[model samples]
Target: MTDPTPLTSLSSALADVVARAAPSVVSVHSHRARSTGFVWKSGLIITADEALADEGEVRIGLPDGSTVAATVAGRDHTTDIALLRADTSIAPVRLTRTVPALGALSVVVATTRDAPSAALGMVSVSGQGWRSLRGGEIDARIELDVRLRSSQEGGLALEASGEAFGMAVLGPRRVLVIPTATIERVAAQLETRGRIARGYLGLGLQPLRLDDGIGAMVMNVDKAGPAAAAGIRQGDVIVAVNDQKLSGVRALLRTLGPASVGRVVDVAVRRGGEPTSFRVTIGERPEA
Candidate 1:
């Protein structure tokens, strides 16, 4: 046997990761009602927007078993990330990196009042887009491919090297963690103004279905809308709206909604891969 024993302990890496990340991982308990007007309770601690479908009150249970009331500070429905501030002060996890490039190994840990669950995976792609949460939608999302357990939905997603990446967000079958890079950017805005500011494009656009490959297609450009005003055509295959790149239908929706009107954002698209650009002056989005 080549050295039956090693000097370092077995759980060293895990222990280090936990030590650095545990403080930020909080236990979220929500008060949702049963159909009968009686409270039939189910619990999930969230660091993601799905947990805050409607902005309201929630009880955050700390690792030390102290529970404090937290209010929804702000929510980016398009990105599926929500910010919650405790009624009392607690130490927060500092975020360092915002983007997880393709092939980056990362770990996810979710804990209930009982146990903690962990899983590992690599970043399949790196980009911001949108996703649907319980009652709302998330935009400018950072998508990942880690397969998350049912218990892992509201937990933390940490990089293998022990940095806090983002919170374990969601997907129907895949684990989507919000990259902390974007979170810090939005959180600053939320902390200052109580909400996230997004650049909006006025018209509704759909993903273009093509025989060659996947891309975004514009179904309609609202009359006198941002796209119309900017001279964007109905058949435009949106490659990039603003700084975020577009790959398909999902990308287009993620970029369009929640974009603030009057903000000037760029739109890069490929009309048959020829590559064109537009200066879109986003207009106001009507209230839902």
Candidate 2:
């Protein structure tokens, strides 16, 4: 028979992985939301935005049974990543850009309420980049076969080699990893600017049918916005942007992502049956 010691050693190694990562794994408490977060930097914590309460005092419970008050540094709902600022000295997690392979043995180091927790599973699906329903840009689509609790939403996903790769959050039917690349990208901007800006045209549009293609009727325009500066009126019907068909309001929004900010696009509109073209510089969407 094959030696059973190998199995025992493997079990001990898995537990060691969790133990090594537990100090940085914190139990997050914000209003009524009880979830997990990991220290991203010396004084910053990253957690799942969907699991964080919108407005409340944020706090994190440390491994040594200590708690510290935190404040919302920034939050991006589109990607379900939120950053918090606190006075903590727990060692920050060393994140890797490595994408796990399918069927790779994985462990999720998280916390339940005020205590640390761990779950073992496999990388069920690993694919290329994907866009979220809210138009957020996710670097990779990595799913796990692990069963995680509601309080373990923002745990760290690690490989058997003890490589901390990404943050695990509960997705629709499975746990998804917010890859290290995406987290590093968004967290840097949030840490510096307090928010990630998206492009905006400042026009409230409704679908309008035209003879040749789809158009959007501008129901409202911000008087102080770029559209207004470009001579676009509320009743103007926008036919195309940069020669692309305006199929729907969502289509228009899709064009106004992060890269669109500061970009100038030719907006073709119809005013009183007269076609008009204007070069308008897209502006950053104002914070709500």
- Return the top candidate by TM-score: 2
lDDT of 1 by residue, 1-288 (tens): 464344344356766776666655656666551000000011212256665536345776666667777676666665555666664444555555656667777777666542444666777766655445322233235556776644456566667677766766667666676666556665555566667544456566665655655667777777766788888887778776675666666455544444354768788877755889999887655545
Clashing pairs in 2: none
For each candidate in the order shown, give its overall lDDT on alpha carbons: 0.59, 0.92
Candidate 2: tens digits of C-alpha lDDT, residues 1-288: 766698898999998999899889998999988999999999999999999998978888989999999999999988899999989889999999999999999999999868889999999998898888888899999999999999999999999999899999988988999999999999998999989889988899999888998899999999888899889998999998888878887878876777889999999999998999989999999998
Give lDDT: candidate 2, residue 218. Answer: 93
